[model samples]
Target: MKINVKLFATFRIGRGKIVYLDYYEGMTVKNIIDELGIKKEEIAIIIVGPHDGTPEKMLTFKVEPNMTVHLFPPVAGG
Candidate 1:
């Protein structure tokens, strides 16, 4: 399965803004993050296809083929 992953904020340091990953069956959002070497605690929000929600729920989400995954880091303000 081909999955499109979009990284936001600090998450795009070494990794590019958009990444294409070839994943296997039953791959969860957390699996993708781990593959990219990103820590779960560093992710604040996750959007999988049409479903968007907290990291807690999204991390465990099983991704489908050709689905786009958006990951955002915590935002800091003055």
Candidate 2:
């Protein structure tokens, strides 16, 4: 299955903003984080779903084909 991945904030320090990955049928958010070399603790938010659909937010959620995943690292603002 092919999914669109968007890395945000600190997650984009080294990697570009977007990447297309060929994931397996039952791949989870953990796999995407590992593949991007980002620690699970580094992720602050995970949005997964179709482009115009309401995203399902959860790290343990199973990623389906053609889903759009947006990964956000911890943010700090004051």
Candidate 3:
């Protein structure tokens, strides 16, 4: 299975804005984040398809083929 991943904010430092990952049957969003070397604490928002991904969901949400996952890091400064 292939999953599309989009990185936003500071999450795109070394990695590009969009990436396609080869995922397994039981792969979760957390697995993708770990493969990209991103810390869970650094992610502020996650959008899996049309749903707002919560922290618990990120850990347990199963990634389906062709699903698009967006990851955003926390932003500061007012």
Identify the runs in model 3 with alpha carbons over 4 angstroms from their true place. none
Higher-ranked by TM-score: 1 or 2: 1
Q: Estimate each model's TM-score.
A: 0.93, 0.80, 0.91
Q: Per-model C-alpha lDDT, please?
A: 0.91, 0.75, 0.87
Query: RMSD in angstroms, candidate 3?
Result: 1.2
Candidate 2 regions exceeding 4 Å error are 50-57
Judged by lDDT relative to the true structure, which candidate is superior, 2 or 3? 3
lDDT tens readout by residue for model 2, 1-78: 687898887677778889889979888877877787877666666777542222234756788887888987667888
Q: Which ten residues in a row have the lowest lDDT in candidate 2?
A: 50-59
Candidate that beats the other on TM-score, 1 or 3, i.e. the better one: 1
Candidate 2 residue-wise lDDT at 48 = 77
For model 1, the local distance difference test gives 0.91
Query: Quick one: ranking by lDDT, best first?
Result: 1, 3, 2
